[model samples]
Target: MLPEKTDTVVVGGGQAGLAMSEHLGNCGIPHVVLERARVAERWRSERWDSLVANGPAWHDRFPSMAFADTAPDAFATKHSVASYFEDFARQIDAPVHCGTEVRKVRRVEGGTGFRVETSKGTIEAQNIVAATGPFQKPVIPPVLPELAGLTQMHSSAYRNPDQLAPGAVLVVGAGSSGTQIASELQRAGRRVYLSVGPHDRPPRSYRGRDFCWWLGVLGKWESKTPPVGKAHVTIAVSGANGGETVDFRRLAAAGITLVGRTQGYDNGVLRFNADLVANIAAGDANYLSLLQEADDYALREGLDLPAESAAHVIPSDPGCLTDPILSLDLAEAGITTVIWATGFAQDFSWLQVDTFGPDGKPQHDCGVATAPGVYFIGLPWLSMRGSAFIWGVWVDARHVAQHIAARHSQATG
Candidate 1:
């Protein structure tokens, strides 16, 4: 295969990018997958050891290959999931140009194609697919000021419980990652403090079934639509409050104390809103009640639902905490480690393309870009839900690859 222009270029060779590459490879199309790092770089580099996917093991498996047949119930470790991607790439012989960081992807004149400028060299393609994932950037809040001089770190920077302080630790964020990390730190014998934030709290299981099984049925595992769009209620709220999900149970079992509320930052002490926990808990209860109504409606309509579902059990309030403003109290409290289990952001400065909208996100639907032949896949909430998930990306990838193939045939003719 001589080096030259190809039909399409898929950017960011993670699971989604590789899935596209695999489809293109089988079709015998001329293509190249440019990866800024080795395959599954984010999972290998960012995620911590104690971090298992919030979703179950079966739900976590990617497209084209299943995770180890042995461990199907439990979630796959980051390393294991990474290896699965590596094996998938090797098996399909995907044309992955590793270590090739893309500088910019500009749509060339006359709509002929795109010029993908990379660290290695320049390459032109009739189409470009930005499979660059949402995990491209770490979203550390500006609220945690730099002048505080506390030992601060994002969850991405954290690897294990030992990395936190041996004494008391403060985890600011009550999301799945935040809750889990806080529990781990407590188990490691470090007195832990948590500043919960706005989030949905779900249990690990309901009626002996994994929580994700409920999500799949209730349209979360493979969310047919966006989260806020589906339910007027939040059935997943709790700490022995309503439903049975992992975060609530694990944190409770760990004996992690719930700081009632945080108002603001003072001289050195963290303040709390008087109604912070109460209000959030109340709101979540109302939300869960709405879910209950929906569930009852479904059942009354003769919807013979699975025995174990999110609706079967009620969840308790996974209380909201005060906003963490690391003034001086952090050091005063002997808080050594700060695990920020916040969510993710995207960084597309490297590749300059119209594919990105005002928010700097890829301007594509599913994998279809506004510009002809310029495509993208594996974006957060892309074309409904599950677009970023391992098994789901391929659904969009197959369609994009077919489009790529058609373009190839047209060009050849």
Candidate 2:
């Protein structure tokens, strides 16, 4: 039962959409939240079974609601996170229409409003909030040539080691997801080859404080988006195994084969970039930088904190750095599965508006798009470094909702 008209329509039912709905309700703006599946569908279905929140439970939740059952320092599992969002939606009384897929959104002819077509029915709205979040579509690079017998899948589709083909696994991309998956596969007795990439390596905790806590205290979450030409790299830290630093050297020492970035597949063999050593060194530098920042902050504030020893600070070079694998034959090494943990791409094809840039990304100032009445939320660095997280989504949602309210008042007044 879709409404014939509404003041606004939120095009997602994940954390972002639910947050937007909460703020809209607070402002007394009538809106409907449309979700393709159940609320927080990605967390419910897309994530790997072993996945946990990278941030601790306390910091990862909405400000108004706490993970009452979860320990403050403990990381909530993916199932818990999904349930948390669903519970929050219920608590806020968000009008989320699950199983309602938004097929297309286009400007209504000769009108200031827009028309949203969904699987259930059509809805006319004055504003549209694209809360589709960051991870919309999985991105698998075309570097590897397709083999007839090879099993391939993205990290999003991966569940557990048992789900993969019983053979050696090649996990491409050294981000948190890739590393975690590769480590899990190796520990599960599969020979794992992890493709190294440029990434920031932050310790899960420092001086009895979680990395997220450090970020909050240091005001790093308030950091703005990178300047033009600079890229934002996600930190490779994990809350698995009761929280631990994501050190490649340690992973390699534990028996995972380390390799350079995947280049392309040559005649029946896969080639990789000869930059494994450089990538390792860069990750080490980022790790050290964080340690240094934390140490300096403690000293400046005269806070008593445990100091890391010099020997502990420097990690021994792994064998992979000295003897990097540049190429490999899948058949020769008995590799059967290739997991692409590369990343995801934005899919706004249904959004028929001129709000996208040359890179196919939404062109917006914060959440407000270039196109009138079109807005975006749940994007990384949308407002700050925290924009993609739970608390940040609420902040940005409130801002967007306020803007919409102002616009509505101006139009109706």
Candidate 3:
């Protein structure tokens, strides 16, 4: 039997939701977490079989649970990450209601609460926390129209090179997914062409320490710098294999052909921008800027950070800097598969409130939605750049939980 109302209701059962529920429980506030599928469904099914957390297991730990028996620097596979969340929820005794899909969330007309309609039942609560992670919907551009014979799949659906058609594969977007997938395919003996895009290619490590460690040391992860209210920068660094940097130079050295950003398809020919070199240069410059910031911070703190080896920096190779292939005839290139590693967009269609900005993203000051009592957790830059990652979500989660608890107390008193 479901309750008619509750003090607070968390809208998802993932790490963010569970984290918020933990805090709510600590405050002696009642709450329930609703999930459309089993906990961490995206980790279980959406990612590739061999995919692991972009950061190390140690950094991926949440406030609810420390990663026990796991190597701190080792990458946690998708299954392991999902299992960790499941275990965390269980150990914390989070009130999670799995298989309960939220169909709609509307303000209780003229009231100080919300009505969350679900597939199972309606949940009335004084507060609602939308803990849906940042990547809500995979963005396959409108220009990615289906070709008659060639196969197409988004990176979210890609498993491995074995699942692809046995021929050349064209990976669009040079972010982490694009670079990583292209590397995997090329190594699997498939000719892979990677399309370079506007991306930041920070090295996986710098100064003999993991780049993330430096960021944490410099207080970048927990920096209270407010978001500029613009689209957040796309960060695409990787920490695979105990922190090996994956960039254009590394991919080219591994036998992957690089191309410019994909423009569109016209008359069965794919078009690309003639800016591959410029894009790569820009990415390298951004990496250098971040490295300089880290160096400055270390200097101010009197830390003796090791200097980076120029030879190990993986600079752009002449062979990889060929003239851009402006237009590619797919058949002539022998490309049989195209994987769009583009990105994702938030989907708040189920949210019946009107506090969203022009970008369709909810406007929140640190996790509290503009519509009072409606909060969001695990959103990109919710508190800082790190807020989107598992290692950083607890910052926003705790704040939201306490905000709700305070509101509940005021109502009761």
Over 4 Å off in model 2, which ranges?
Answer: 227-232, 310-312
Q: Give the clash total for candidate 2.
A: 0
Candidate order by lDDT, highest to lowest? 2, 3, 1
lDDT of 3 by residue, 1-413 (tens): 45779988888888788788888898889888998898888888888877878887778888557776568888888888899988898888988888999999998987778898999989899888898887789988777566547898899999987898788999988877777788888888989899987677666778777777877886768866743532444566665555567677778877888888888887778888888888888777778877888778878888887877562464546574765678888888899999999889888899888789988778999999898888999887788878888867877787887888788878889
Q: Per-residue lDDT of 252-300 in model 2, one digit per residue for the tens?
A: 9999999998998876689889999988888888788888899899999
Backbone collisions counted per model: 27, 0, 0
The runs of at least 3 residues in candidate 1 whose Cα sits more than 4 Å from the true structure, single-residue gaps closed, are 109-111, 220-224, 227-244, 247-253, 260-266, 272-275, 278-328
User: Across residues 1-413, which tens digit of lDDT does each residue of candidate 1 receive?
Assistant: 21457778889889888888888887778888888889989888887775555565576665457776326666666777788888888888888898989888787778688888888888888878878876777876765455555677888888887665465777766765676677667777877777654555554554444555655666654555655533322233222212234344336446665553344554556654454455356545544654564466457766654544555444454432434233336666687656666667777676665566777667766677776777778875676566777777887788888888888888888
Model 2, CA-based lDDT: 0.89
The TM-score-based order of candidates, best leading, equals: 2, 3, 1
